[model samples]
Target: MTPPSDPARIPGDAPDESELGRIAADLGLDIGAQHLAEYRLLIKQGLGGYSRLDELTSPPPTARHYDRDPGYLPGPDENPYHGWAWRCSIKGAPHGPLAGRRVAVKDNISVAGVPMLNGSPIMRGFIPHEDATVVTRLLNAGAEIVGKTAVPAFCADAAGLTGLEPQPSNPYDPTRLPGASSSGNAVVIVSGQADLAVGGDQGGSIRLPAAWSGCVGLKPTYGLVPYTGAFPLERTLDHVGPMAATVADCAAMLEVMAGADGLDPRQQLDLAIGSYTDMLEEDLRGLRVGVLREGFGIPGVSEPDVDAAVLAAAGTLARGGAEVMEVSVPLHSDGLSIWSAIVFQGATELVTRGDAIGANWNGHFDLDLVDFYRRAKPAHPAEFSPTVVFTVLFGTYLTEQCGHRYYVKAQNVARELGRQYAAALETVDVLLLPTAGMKATQRRTDGSIAQIVARALGNMHNTAPFDATGNPALSLPCGFSDGLPIGLMLVGRRYDDETVLRVGHAYEQLRGPLAVQPPKLADRR
Candidate 1:
């Protein structure tokens, strides 16, 4: 993702007083002309100090070769599905758990030599020279790296459409969104292009896409899976997990990707987790499943059929011997606002600050992002999509103008939300809800930036709170509404990913496979 060049700015070596004034003005600083020129010289000297950072000292490309990058566009287009397809075969163990599995990674995760677009034009040519921790784990488990998938710019949108890359479409209907941020990962899975994909979720990225695409997506317990290597968006909210065709497959992928990588600070070294796949049994006898009351009733926003379908799925689990009951967490309703404050401020901090604020277990930072933020000044901010432009502006304004007061308040409220969910989990093994209010939405061709923000924000109502509270959440296709699939989310106690997976697996078995298939690839078999 290469930042578009701005002709008005002075080149790195040649610092112009006018350019410094322009930067200071954009930052809302009020410095006098004499001091400003001195400041410009100081800034130029400081910039000179970073010459070493610009040099790519990484070792040679690790993959077999630099492969083809199919552009976004479905049918006769280099990339028909807007799914970035490349071939990087780094075969691992001959007889590992994931042997023979074809896997796609969301672009945010480093693939060592593969260009990580992060679904933005800003990072276009930046190729990481080292594999992300999950990539190494996947290869160790014998999964073949098929390629990278499209992501929303900075993983901010849940629209499944990249602002600058190919807009990923629902395989069932090209007019519909494919589920976002992890849009390309879901696209490849439903389109039968890959067996599984490793996706990162800060909000509902993995699950949202999985639901729309009719696949299983899991956001592993916070810290259960290492976050080393993937780009960060709100450190506390970040999660990396697997999206697969089935619950069992997803579990297997998680088994391989989970556990402490030593480099991921989020992982608790002594945390004990069981074999998630083994927990998948036909019977849910005696398990208590709480149907979250607030999960529905979004008034005009939530579709009745979608809620009914999820409720029915819970009832099916009840019939299989699980005790189902309704539970209320009042704060659950405020998820969107809380998530927005925390994420916007935190993301703004990382984007605007030269370095990450939190502990870096992986000993790595996105120097590329820092480079972009400092230099990006196209006349129109040319390469940024309306959605990204909106996010950056919103985040930066909130961070700078409000001085992060909302961010602090959001974190305080988030703790209460976590406590509320924890208290409910004490009585119930897992909480269930409609993964989202509606099924896959039709891609809007005439949307304003406001509408795009609204759509993306709407998709996260049910999923973002868990990110804030650091819970294990999973989204699986419970049923279909109209011709598109609907997702049912199961949230478990922090560090209790197995319970969530078990409940989801049991429900998956009881409901059976979804009848609907992505229309475009239904005949692929």
Candidate 2:
């Protein structure tokens, strides 16, 4: 007789009960069996539902997490005063202007009283004495944080949800992955759990998730948002940006978070250039948007569905009187190494400095290190996988040795490309392109080399360069394929966010009212 089929198993489903228990144990949280079942169901629906930011719009039980505090509670309550844990003390005061606005903070960032794991088990019980500079800015501006969101085991995993990590379930399909290291934050906002979410992008962390989840994410030029009191990723390239249901929402969050903080010694020390929030509604009647079609048409990329979405969005811009032109970026496929180098350097620093930060990694990481290598690393060092030591470690050595030369070359190329694209933008309001060549990869049940690497490549294609260029980019849900949402990326020249945002706002409005709700789990309902 054939073996009985397992009801609990979904091909490539991640974090089984045993695995979930390990994560819970590592964090010292009590997760009930019922909660796990609910979470699993939520995960399954998320794969099919929330990724497009269509799910979770309507109230549902799967939206609540048993292991965490109440997230869906309605209120205009202002949250967080900056260093990590939320200062939910302002419940009944005059509703902050952003009172009704809901937000989710990337877990790696500081939120007072909230335990920021930094995606590492090492910082398990950490509670910052103060808020991150960005957090304080949010509260003062009246944005209410719905809750702290989850991240990959470390913020350095550039593959986003490429498949190897235990961190977050891509809301689109439980069978597939959500791009990470900023997993939870993106899922929540796109699922409509919040109106805005702030994500830190060092190597495409914010943009990857935004692309996968079909929302708007911005990686402000480095130093736009103060990093004071937040855990470090590479001190050099670390950036804090906004993740929201719309580009306008992200702009509002940026208004609060952008600025140098006296407390953070590493702050860029540059004067804040007025408010990013002020630019959200700027006119975009005539602007130039560049379409870098190079590498976009490569195999495993520019899938038919995404290509159509890109063209469709570009058409939308043309209809609005903006000019669109095709351009090329010296960004080769091998550019992942450039991103990997910066990312690995930061992870290595955090892993080494765990003790200094009073972090919580001992139990989870020591075990995970062995499991990660076994599950994902290629037998040959050249294979791609986000969690493999070979990937991260090798990147460290490359960056240490040849990083400067490559960075300079990359920057020069980027400058030339920017100048070229900027010229196009002189007439186009927003550049249009498939935010990523492929849809989010299917979730990895096994975390093998093949699964992980493929997903990472797909995750980084459209969003990474903007990080290096320090240009403002916007993503809007253009359409869907096989039920997964695809995004239209709008790249604007440095500090031209207002122009890009107005374009995004106008697009969002043209797309019509986008109100999507999470799939209902009858048991929870």
What TM-score fits each model?
A: 0.85, 0.69
- Candidate 1 accuracy as lDDT: 0.78
lDDT of 2 by residue, 1-81 (tens): 111222122344545777777787876789987688677766766665335543334332111111223233122222111
* Model 1: lDDT of residue 263: 63
Error of 2 at 172 (Å): 3.4
Model 2 residue runs over 4 Å out of place are: 1-95, 159-167, 263-283, 330-337, 345-388, 399-429, 453-458, 514-525
lDDT of 1 by residue, 255-295 (tens): 89888866666778787867887877746877899999999
Off by over 4 Å in 1: 1-80, 85-87, 355-362, 366-380, 519-525
Native-structure RMSD, model 2: 16.9
lDDT of 2: 0.58
